[model samples]
Target: MTREAMAAFMFRMDGTSSYQAPKVSPFADVKPGDKFYREISWMHSQGLSTGTRQTSGKPLFQPKAALSREAMAAFMFRLEKPKAYQAPKVSVFSDMKPSDKFYREVSWMYASKLTTGYKAPNGSRSFGPKQSLTREAMAAFMYRLETTLRLK
Candidate 1:
């Protein structure tokens, strides 16, 4: 699924059935003309997505960009807003360390069973946090999330 579709799905799951765009948009890339404008705007307004390149003058949502594993973790973490989530001292992925920016979220993903990292022949697991998330993986993630949360 596209990033916009994922954002819209998350919003709908969060009970945001419909909404109008804010007078001032938080994203420079998502404008009135965009098809997922409302959904993207709602996500940004709710602080779920901060965009990848916001610091640059031309901030972009990159709705068509492939969603990365780490990005998905961050998005779900924000959506869940779990109370008092604490990361373990060590990370489960051999490639990802505790100091990594996405470590906490990825750790939560593993602990919550939202993901099981790719295992190599050497018996080491890699989260592949920067890799693109596949459609099947996205569906599994959403399914697991709904099952875990028991969201109607």
Candidate 2:
């Protein structure tokens, strides 16, 4: 799914049956008339997203971009808004480094037992941060996220 679609799905998953569009969209790419404008606006208001980039000093949401696994992790982590959460100093996966943009979120996912990553033939695990999130993976993540939230 696109980032915009993910944002909208996550918003609904947050139990929002309905929402009103903000007077202004914080994203340069999302206009008031855009299909997911209200959901994206709500995400911005809730601190769930700050957009993917900035152009001319205005934030661009990159609504049409495909959702990556790491980005999904970040979104889920933000949705939980865990308090006093600290990412591990050591990397949990062979591919994910501490310096990566979504390291904290990916680490949090492992720490929270939301994901175990994929094991390789070399006996190493990879988070596949840049990979497009498959529908099955997304379902698993959502199920795990719901379970995690219920336990909290």
Among the numbered candidates, top TM-score falls to: 2
> Best by lDDT, which number?
2
Could you tell me which residue pairs clash in candidate 1? Answer: none
What lDDT does the true structure give each of the candidates? 0.82, 0.87
Q: How many clashes does each candidate structure show, in the order listed?
A: 0, 0
RMSD of each: 2.3, 1.6
Residue 82 of model 1, lDDT score: 74
Query: Model 2 off-target regions past 4 Å?
Result: none
Tell me model 2's lDDT, rounded to 2 decimals. Answer: 0.87
Candidate 1 on 24-127: residue-level lDDT in tens? 66777677868778888888878888886755574678888778888889999888887898999978899899998879999998888888899999998899
> How far off is residue 133 in model 2, in Å?
1.5
